[model samples]
Target chain A: MASVLASAHPQETVYGQVGDATVPLRFSSLDEEYKVLRERAAVLDLGGHGLIEITGPDAVAFAQRVLARDVEYLTSDRCMMTLLLDADGQVVDQVLAFGREDGILLESSCGAGARLLAHLRANNDEGVEIADRSGDLTVLGLEGPYAWGVVGRLIDGELASLPFESVVDTTWNGADIVFARTGFTGEYGYQMIVPIEHAADLWRQSLEHAQAAGQEALELAMLEVRQPIPRHEVTEGATVVEIGANWLVDVTKDEFVGREAVLAAFEAGGGRRTVGFSGGDGVPAPGTRVWVNGQDIGEVVHAVHSVGLGATLGLARVDHDLAAAGLELTVGGTEVTTLTSPYIVPKSWSIPII
Target chain B: MTIDELRARAAERQQTCSQIKKMIVSRLDLEIDPDWITDDQPLFGRGLELDSLDVLELYVAIEAEFGVALYDSEMAVFGSVSRLAEEVNPALRA
Candidate 1:
């Protein structure tokens, strides 16, 4: 189904594997897409992300036992970021769990659907039903400071007052669509989920609306800059604490899988910490070794030349001691100054005072 | 101020420090005991080993607990429990 959207950029699009599907990588120049996403608004195809639906009476209770967040406390009108972990506290998949009226919907990496479903079923206490809806659902990502305006124009209800991570259901031309005030681009954005039949039409309509409204379409690469921590770093053998996502883990919760392991790691002090670096001579490719004091400390997980920040930014999992900002580290033999994540703050989302 | 008044003021400051220390421990989900947090021990780097994210969480927790807002520029106040007490006590009094 995403191939329909990918077809639009036939000449300029590059294909990349995201989970089980090959989605459009770049519709145009990376820099242009980055600029559109930063300065204005842009639409992105998030069709590659897997969507899973869990229903029945035990759905929420079962999820609360498996996921690493306070799933039981999640309100039906909102969504929360959660992590699936192995018994050893290693991250399996990062997911956004949306509490729905009927059940819970989980959006995760494409390839993780089967595994996640299997894990859920193995622990299922009966009266629970889980189904992979990735093939039936298509997600469109609208991001930037002006993204809310684009979404506000399409939906019938008022979205201006909606808080982040809140989900609202609406219809477009008789097609059922769900818009969630959530995104990975560190901007005020929405991820719209529509039925597969309406996917192509909705994608085209969203693009047409943005274009008519004088906004540009962004490629998926724009996500590289806005991500607080790249997905690979979190999924590849990095614990939640090591990635500085301790806030996501509810240690007070009773008996979630990997809770004990995570608690132990936190107590014993987790290993390498993920930190951001910038002002480098060039963009250090992923897996580039990071050197400190002539010693190999760690390697870069992801790096890109950020047009918005006007510097080559990279996220690296380095020694915990060197994770502090303003430290100088050598990445791919070029000196880079370490800085914190969200190098460029979005104009739309403001940090709440309380 | 009189000697008794000075003693009472010192006691109030000490109570604030303990409250802040407990908040940090509970909020960050740290394993360390609140009693281990000395008044002068640095919250970041060598002392508590808290990184930038921890500082942000601590700021939010402090605001939620004490109704005192900590600005990004005033991060140095988080350098020690005593400093946090100094910042939070006035707000609590107010």
Candidate 2:
């Protein structure tokens, strides 16, 4: 799937491993690509993300038992961010579940589709049908302040009216397409899923539409800066509470895969919380050791030079007390200060009505 | 109150507002200068554009700085710097 995108940018494109796939790390200069996303709209190919479908009479029940978020209450029009966990409360993957008439569609990070599908099958006592649809579906991300406007020109009906995490199935150029008001970027954005055969056509049309609207297309490098924490940071050993994703854990639910462990961890106060840090003279690469007064506290998970903030920003798992804003820490022998996530608060965060 | 006392009180209030503005910038690690934050500019929506989680950080900052614990019900006072200033002054006086 990525070969199609690679063929387009023969001069400036570079590929890197995201999950199991080698995706475009950048199409051109990182700063310029990032600038387009911050100032205007840009389209990104997120074909690596895993898509799985679970259907049957017991689909909702099976999902509710396995996922951290309350899947039982999710309706056909809405989507919810959830986490799949091991029995020991370690995070397996972060997933977004969209409720549809046939069943529930789950989208996970790259390289996690098979594991998630296997987990579902192992726990499926209710005869739910599970299928991995990653190869068949292509995910495209449209981001920036003007993303809504660009998407509005391509689809029917008013897209602005759709709330965040709302999913709507629509047709584009005689082919079926699904649009979700969800994105990793802390801006107005949408994720469009199309059939694999129509992906190249959709990608071309989306870029053309965005360019016609005086916007530039972006690549994965731009998207990385927008995300507060990368998925790799929360891999296998990390818990939801430790990652500061406690909001996604529905404690009111009677049971889930790792509910007991998570509850116990919550009561005991999980160690090594995820914190956002910025204002360092040098960008701390991922896996860099974070220190406090010469003591090794945690390690950097995601780091990037934020052109918008005019400083290097990174996310790390540090001591919980040090996670508060204004605390100073050392990364690679240089001092850096902590800040809250969504490092650059977008106008969308201000729109309380949404 | 006498004119002199009223003037003194106003000056003290202005000082507190300035302090809170600086505290907001420092505690939130805001990129902009403290002086850039106008009194009427909102702390959450539109102006500063802080989310609810950021508000939690601000709560901790306010308590640690002014020894005033902000209750959830008092969050309405965070509409603007002036509003927060108005709420914090009485707590400081107490």
Candidate 3:
């Protein structure tokens, strides 16, 4: 699926196939876009992300059973990021779930909407109404240390400070839209779920305040903050514990789809844990062997040349005993040092919303 | 470092991270096991879903538990358990 606003994109836009959707990989260059995302603000065409709506009386109940996190008290004005897991506790997709007055709206990770919709429909024993709302609604994002400023200029100033995970039903160009303080890159981020007809206008207006960034830059910034990227990190048979996404699972919930398997994995323990590493000559591909001296401990799960770090940043699923940061590990033939999470401290952490 | 030496170093950071995790869980009264919180999982905004108030509580908890005051430190200090481990136990830092 191509972005709904692709017609408005620049002629120089570079696009790539990512699963079910064809997405812009970069507008100018990855480095330029990445710098904008971290230092200033970058507008994102998140049309590749699927928006699925679940309604009817059992909407919340059905959502409660399907979502890995506790959303029982998730009010209409709030949204939270959680994982949709299969029976085996393997991730289906990481989603931003918005609580709507009628039911719940889920924004699937870029290019994973179809799979998420299928997973939800297959498990919908509660007979709730499931609809793929992507045709009618699409997502746009603004992220960076100064993304809050763009939010104020583009929409409402108050919405910029709506607290993290907070959502509001509002308008843009007189079109009913849902605005949420959602982020992927650990920066001051906000998402606008607008009607398809009004998406192009919002995207253009946003461009005036922020430069456009594509999927590559967005994913790179997310990696820097150690945000779980399901596409890159969720390898086959990799348990949530091994993926280091335990926080996305609500083990405390009495019953949820993958709770049993996730709990079992956690109790089983001693699985390979994922850690961040840097300082490699080239980006290592997934499954590249990670070595500690002569011992083959694990493999690279995901990696990229981080523009922020000016080095190759990657995650290795190493044995639990050797997963901590500040260790010298070899990936393939190049030596890399496992570093602390948030490999690049997000400037948003220090910048407050004014 | 050699394999054994690297293992020892990794173990040292892991121990400190474990202590920090335990302190966070205990102080915040979280229900999950401290070990469940991975060394690399984010601690605020997205991962653990900690808020500013939680940070305030953690500030006191960290000083009491580690005998190190983080009152003046930037919010980046709590980026993750491993990051916090570095601040609480400076020896764990690279």
Q: What is the TM-score of each candidate against the true structure?
A: 0.75, 0.75, 0.98
Ranking by lDDT: 3, 2, 1
Q: Please identify model 3 stretches exceeding 4 Å from their true place.
A: none
| Model 2 per-residue lDDT tens digits across residues A237-317 | 766666655545666678999999988877776376776678767777778998766778788877767766778777777
DockQ for each of the predicted structures, in order? 0.05, 0.04, 0.87
Model-by-model lDDT, in order?
0.67, 0.67, 0.91
lDDT of 3 by residue, A1-354 (tens): 999999999999999988799999999999999999999999999999999999999999999999998888889999999999888888999999999888999999989999999999999999999999999999999999999999899889999988889999998889998999989888999999999999999999999999999999999999998898888999999999999998888888899998899999999889799999998688899999998777899999999999988999999999988888888888999989899988999898889899
Error of 3 at A183 (Å): 0.7
Sum up the clashes in candidate 3.
0
Better TM-score candidate (1, 2): 1
RMSD of 1: 9.7
Q: Whose DockQ is higher: candidate 1's or candidate 3's?
A: 3
| Candidate 3 displacement at residue A320 in angstroms | 0.9
lDDT of 1 at B11: 52
* Per-residue accuracy of model 1 over B1-94 as CA lDDT, tens digit each: 3324433544565578779889988998876567445444445432455877898888789889988888654455664565567677764232
Interface RMSD of 2: 15.9
Interface CA RMSD, all predictions: 14.9, 15.9, 1.0
Query: What fraction of native interface contacts does model 2 preserve?
Result: 0.00
